[model samples]
Target chain A: MNMIEAAAVHVRFGDRVVLESVDLAVAEGEFHGVMGPNGAGKTTFFNVLTGRVKPNRGRVLLAGEDVTGLSPHRIAAKGIARSFQIMTLFDEFSALDNVMMGLPEFRARSHDVARAAAGDSRFAAKSSEALAAVGLADKGDIRAKDLSYGDRRALEIAVALAQAPRVLCLDEPTSGLGSDGVQRLAALIARLKGRLTIVAIEHDMEFLFSLADRISVIHWGQVVARGTPHELQQNEWVRRSNLGKFA
Target chain B: MAAPLLVLDDVRKVYTRGRVIRRPTFTLQANLSLDEPDIVGVVGPNGAGKTTLFEMMTGSNAPTSGRVLVAGTDIHGVKYRERDRLAIHYHQSYQVRRFRKRIPSAFLAPSPTRTPLVHLFDEPQFNLQDGYIGFMLDFFRKLRDEGRLVVLCMHPTAAWHLDILAEIAGRFLFVAGGGVTAVANFGALVADPRCRSYLGPEMTKAADAICHGAVHSST
Candidate 1:
């Protein structure tokens, strides 16, 4: 059964139609990639999936249960967690504290997240496990700002992982990373591929094409094309362009 | 027998400057009928009123004179918020122009359909590297096959851009100097002297190559 589905999603801001009719169905444990040019309504579609923006029409289903128009916090609690394209980590907080702050248990228990992270053993263990999943277990003591750019990205993923979400929605995870950073991130994503359902919007075509089980090309606020990486690259124009070089 | 998909019945739009003097700065006129489901390519130079023409077609900007019909329903007469049900305009960035409402939405007629009959894309950016061009072209065909009129307005800067326009569009509308000229096919569009001038030397050569069946034979 499909884990997350957006059916005929339509979003319009005033007279401008942002997403015409976007339909996507990501199966359980599948790595789905969403790629599109800038201003193609890719982010808006992400927003709709994660409940940041509600569609003017259509439905978003989570495991056959309708979850459209739910609040962001409600959606997050329902096992859909997301990381932002622009990093949202607290610069002054330790990596562990950031992850702990994301833990639902920790958030529910105390409003003082920084203090609670250090005092609570269960929360600390859970945060450490999340950090280890993203290869940041040893770097938990360091402040987010002190970590390398790559480590910071990993830490952000760790924060989302702390939620133990069923579906992880990543927005431009590979952005602002060097070649080495991208490779590390790819390996991390590879490790988590089968264990978790992932939906990523990425500009790094090679990264997405390599890791994604199936990819959807979004343009004009709609899913313009979709297929496996090999199937998509078979287009004559794609073969002529740099994207074909990946194959 | 069924109402034509889209019809611009002698539509005219005039943008005038100076509220008191009301001197006309720009004017665009179009009279055409797309009776069937097909992808119609729109090409023209900058400030040739392509954007204005799209606005009028989608009912965002009211025509100064005539009617813009989508499957026999006059879009201007439709409810303000529900106008998109008849025709939707995907603007470039946040270039959505706001026009004054002449009549209250309660007085306007409701849209006859749920989905837009006329889809007008204004200069949608087509990037080649990501390989989304193929998908977009296919989507245009899908909309056409669903019995909808798809109007694509593009500013052809590259050779491949012209290739895409030639390949995807069954007909062409060359908008220039406030007038719209409809061409039946790609070969005819390239043959017109005004279109040649608008395309420039490099693009014109590419367009001619496409017309002679010398390019993009792969698909």
Candidate 2:
């Protein structure tokens, strides 16, 4: 069954139409990638899915329920979670505290950070489970500020996992990561795939191709192509869009 | 020898959020100098301080230690208005309006009346369309023609721009963990472990990936 779907989505800012009649569908437990050239309204599509940017007209369905036009907080409550291109963690907090802050119960989860709690066993257990899921099991005590860049990103995902989201959205999760970092993240995503419906916007086509079961290419704010990795590679427009660079 | 047009003498920037919660901290630790009008490709993974370098150059954030020099004058010592005129940082969005009316002066030629200037652009690939990418590349070349220094900062995602810049960019400055490491050209860049290791697979490949239009340019 399609866990998430967008129908005829249209989003615009003033005279600029960022997203035009965009449609996307993701099956349950599927890893979906979004690829586009720069300024293709890819970011807007991301925002629309996360409920951060409400489409001027359209419908967003999360598990067959209407989620369009909802605030990011409401969407998070609906089991949708997102990590940012920029680190949104409270730098001063410990890894455990950071993950705890990502729980839906821990204040809305709109990248609006909640104060880190010193010792809450209940939150600690939940956050620990999350940290372990992302392989940061022993690093929970380390401050978010002190974690290595790769670990910090993992912690961010752990935070999202703590929410127990059905659908997790990663915005350029590997943008700043090194080769080792990229491999580490790819491994984490690989392990998490069957358990979560994952949607990612990635510029690194290699990472996207290796991890995404299916991908949809957005151009001019519309999804011009959607198919398996092999199909996308065969696409003329995707090829001309410099898909060769990634190869 | 005339001093370099730009210099960072052990520059550092620190942040202190709360007295009890967080102590003082430093994010940027830059120590480098550049003299030529080389088209320097500023690249690193995210959080590598590529943007911070531009910020320090534009005088938006004052470094906690050391100095930033443009034409031998300390940018930190000058008022923001003066720094604004000297250091122009162009982000990807037109809404920024910070450096609106920005042109390719450095790539081509300066106004002749103004002092020799440096234009710092962070991720100029944003919002660009299909045909316009080449246009922007040509514009930067024009700036180079005019005898201005251009620092083109690109995130790994936009590393494809490196292929285009490589043909013209005389140097590649790899920023990792806030420090600066410079390579002579694209040949040295891909060969250096720093460039390959720091960038993701696509960007690493792009370090040597030549734009089709300029296949012989040697990325």
Candidate 3:
């Protein structure tokens, strides 16, 4: 069964439709990549998954359970963790603290635990491990406000990883990174393969090509093509669309 | 020729917590000449003292030794109120609680005496949801066109915003361990041979520094 399934979903704002009859499914432990131009409804799709937007029509299923109108927090509780295109780190908080905030249902699950225990040596170890996984292990204590841009992006990924979710969604993970930085992120994603299901929206074709197991092209709020990276690379229609430039 | 935009001479800082003395006297002497717009990238390892250098440069923390001059004027010599009036520091983890709120008009407020140089410690890592990233990119561009110098201190992960940084600032500075190892125009910096070599090392350091503060114990 698919981990996440969106069937014939439609989303509109006033007279404009952002997503029209879009159908997509994420298999267990699959690394899915969504590629498109601006206004192609990539972010709108994320909104639908997180229940930030109620689809005008159609249904969303998580692990075979219908969740079309569930709240974002509820969806998150159900093992979905998303990192924004632009980072949402807590500036005043330390990097470790930011990752702690991303822990799944920690508030309720660890309520009985004392504050000192919450900030215990073990928790710190886990946070450090997450930081190191994203190549930010050394920056655990620096305030979010003090990091450089590339490091901040890595921290965002670290926060998502901290959730230990079954599904991970990343928006434009390589949007502003230089070539080397993009390569590092791709390497990190590659390492996480098979352990988690990933759905990423990205514009950088090079990085996506290297990291994505499957590619879905979105345009005019619809799924124009879906295939393995090589298949999508050869599709005639994809060749004619925005994917051509990247090709 | 047009007066150094920012100058630092033998700047030193010491962190002493009781008996534990960490780098009691770290020094950096640099002459930064910014006659036009520039984007400087400060790169360093965690505990390499990147933030400490920024603090001393921006006057957020006083240096144990040496002088910092901005626009041919000694920043340390100026009164705190006057310095505050002349500088704007945007730290990382800068949050935008409201998406609808307009960009602070104070950012665009006129400065008749000298061109305002904005310091963004980690502006890109802040809340960038709801088109705010585009808004900030455009805003910084305008500041650059007006001849303002914008300095951004970024960790390796936040390095993706360099495109926006390049569009806004013409020059760049890469600081590591309370010192600048590389300085150039945004274009030149990207193409610089030294930038690639030093970027990874400096980023690792910055990340280490952040981790040190967050975990508060050995990894």
Q: Better model by TM-score, 2 or 3?
A: 2
Is model 2 an incorrect, acceptable, medium or high docking prediction? incorrect
Model 3 lDDT per residue over B1-219, tens place: 665656666666655555655644455545455555555555445556666666556555666677776666665555442343344444432331111213333443332232235444443442222222333444455556666566666544443344344444455566554556555555455444555555565543433444244222211
Candidate 1 CAPRI level: medium
- Give the residue spans of candidate 2 off by over 4 A: A108-116, A236-247, B1-219
Candidate 2 iRMS, in Å? 10.4
* lDDT, candidate 2, B121-214, per-residue tens: 6776533223234434544565566666778876655654555566557787888866788878777777778777876677666666552333
| Span of ten consecutive residues with least summed lDDT in model 3 chain A | A235-244
Q: Pairs clashing in candidate 1?
A: none
- Over the stretch A1-247, how does candidate 2's per-residue lDDT look in tens digits? 7999999888767534567558999999999998776787888888998888988889999999999989998999899998988889988988988888777766542344443365457777998999998889999989999999999989889988899998999989998899999999999999999889999999888898888999887755657567787766653323444453443
Write one digit per residue (lDDT tens) for candidate 3, span A46-145.
9999889999888988888998989998888887888899789988888887887677655555754347335567667777889999998788889898
Residues A1-247, candidate 1, lDDT per residue (tens digit)? Answer: 9999999999998766889889999999999999988888989998998999999999999999999999999999999999998999999999999899998878889997657866988888999999999999899999999999999999999999999999999999999999999999999999999899999999999999899999999888888889999999888778877788888
Q: Which residues of candidate 1, in runs, are more than 4 Å off? A: B15-26, B216-219
Higher-DockQ candidate of 1 and 3: 1
